[model samples]
Target: MMTDLVTSQPAMRRLRLSPTLSKYIARQYLSWFCSFFFAIVAIIYLATIVDLLDRLATKDVSLGITLNMAFLKLPYLSQEVMPFTILFAAMATFWRLTRSHELVVARAAGVSVWQFLLPVLASSVVLGALAVCALNPLSSVLLSRYERLEANYVRNQASMLAVSETGLWLRQADESGQSVIHAESIKPGSVALQQVMVFRYAEQDRFVDRIDAREAQLQSGRWLLFDAWLARPGVPSEFHEQLALPTDLTADNIQDSFAPPETISFWNLPGFISLMQAAGFSATPHRLQFHRLLALPMLFAAMVLLAATFSLRPQRRGRVGVVILAGMLTGFLLYFLSNFVFAIGLSGTIPVVLAAWAPAGVSLMLGVAMLLHLEDG
Candidate 1:
């Protein structure tokens, strides 16, 4: 009994860390994280600028606008690669410390691996939280602007659709001019609308006519309005049992016109989901995004754990290259797994929660298992 108690005391001591030591270790990890993060983002920004310039080569867009587009897109791109940044940053931090024998000295002093890792893990959690809460909204806003710029300058088209609690708004434009359509409600899984209004405009933005309809259906290249009343300026209103309006919009176009889930801020997702569902549209993508944001901190912690397993070794081990390669491969594998699972979730083949959380949960468990094998076995 006495022997057991003595052994437990050492384990308890190993679990504790001094505030100063914790702060130092956390600072070191964050320093490396910021360095790698900015370096990677800079490279991505340059690449994006080049790509934009190429896309606008045939267009008359100014270089300033092209640069602006890239800048707006950079935050979203950073979000996409953040997990890898954390993983590589963690790996570099641990590898450097191990090579410097700082961790080695701590281990000799009876500071267990878990004790020193606490600070890094905590830092990662905080970083992940900040990314989700702060960076995500910023990224979403910038990405939305980037899309608008791309549509206006690169694609030479304006946004065609918007959905909200009030209803759905759609705009179609062609050589004939433009029409704006509004519907208070939409039929589930179809392009049929109820309580519709269409506003027509002629060339040079001249007001042409307005139509109010009880129902409207989008067919191949036109909208068929039933029981519609047409009113034109300086002319008598007319009632029609049926009317057809030419449109460049199709059902597929309407579906594609929705704001991509990535462009919606995390804070706005829940309300957006509610709006979509209330409007009889699928909210699966937004739901998935919300869950993914909720799981980000856990994912970051898992990354740190995985990085530790690969890098917390002595410099004399002589397997540094192999370890680094293996770590990178593992990171890539996890990324692929996440994408594949997200696809399945988006297709409704798996629950959103499972698809969003599984990769991080699995990676975390694997990291914990490996750490146990190395430290205790």
Candidate 2:
């Protein structure tokens, strides 16, 4: 009994130290991550604020409002740079530890590479999950508000499109008057609407007339209606087989008018997707965004693996710079590839799920393969 107790004491002490070590590593990683993240955000803000400042000079918006837009947009931009932050932070952490021979000491103490890396990977995954589940909703709401302010104050525009259970609604304004257009359904990729109603309002906001049509086709600078009914408050409605209404809107403008995927919170996306589909608009972008958010944590975890694969080993004096640069370039390539595939998916050349998951899947696999080659080969 005395011998058994003596042997187990070392193992028990090691077990207790393991959690302490994990916490320490996670704290270091998170600190470095926040440092890199804010650094990048600051750089982006400086780059963008110049143009915003110029635009604001020509508008009535105050400097405070412009700064608010910049701050409001920061969260959404943070989500984009998070994976890079993880990669850089992990690489820096492991490189520092390895350079200082801490990892060598740990290995001599029987701690394997896998054991230390486990905590870093877990931390990255947790960060990714928090970004998607918590940060995303907050960013979306603020981004939507920023866009509204930009439209109202900076660009002098109003709401362009809306979706409801009954149908799709659109609004347009010109020097003559404003028009509200409604359609029971819309045909994606084309500027055509079915079962259309148009309400015309004069310069003083007086109701001028209403037009109903079985179908309307948006063409260059005009809308062509088939079987139209024109009605005025004091006159009997007149029916026409064909009528053309002047418009400043084009097909591209109409298609670009929907609430962009970034503005809708993750919690609200599924309902928005259903509503958009029901209203006969392509909900592909929203679906793609939701799937991407679903896959984000795994993506960030994969970044940890890749970072470790590059920096976990001992750093050689002459080769260290090259290795870090190569790792950064690799991350850049992965980002570009993900974007290319996403664009393809948006164009309907591939499935949305494939586009959304491919970046993380490929990163995870590549990282695993490299780690295997280094550790086991």
Best by lDDT: 1
Backbone Cα, N, C clashes tallied per candidate: 0, 0
lDDT of each: 0.90, 0.88
lDDT of 1 by residue, 198-310 (tens): 99998998989999999999898889999999999999999999999988787877777889888999999999888888777788888999999999999999999999999
Candidate closest to the true structure, highest TM-score: 1
lDDT of 2 at 93: 91
Clashes of 1: 0
Candidate 2 stretches with Cα past 4 Å from truth are 1-17, 152-156
lDDT of 2 by residue, 110-225 (tens): 67678888889889989998999899999999889888988898878766988888898989988889999999987776778999999999988999999999999998889999
Position 150, candidate 2: lDDT: 82
lDDT of 1 at 273: 88
Off by over 4 Å in 1: 1-15, 234-236, 315-317
Candidate 2 lDDT score relative to the true structure: 0.88
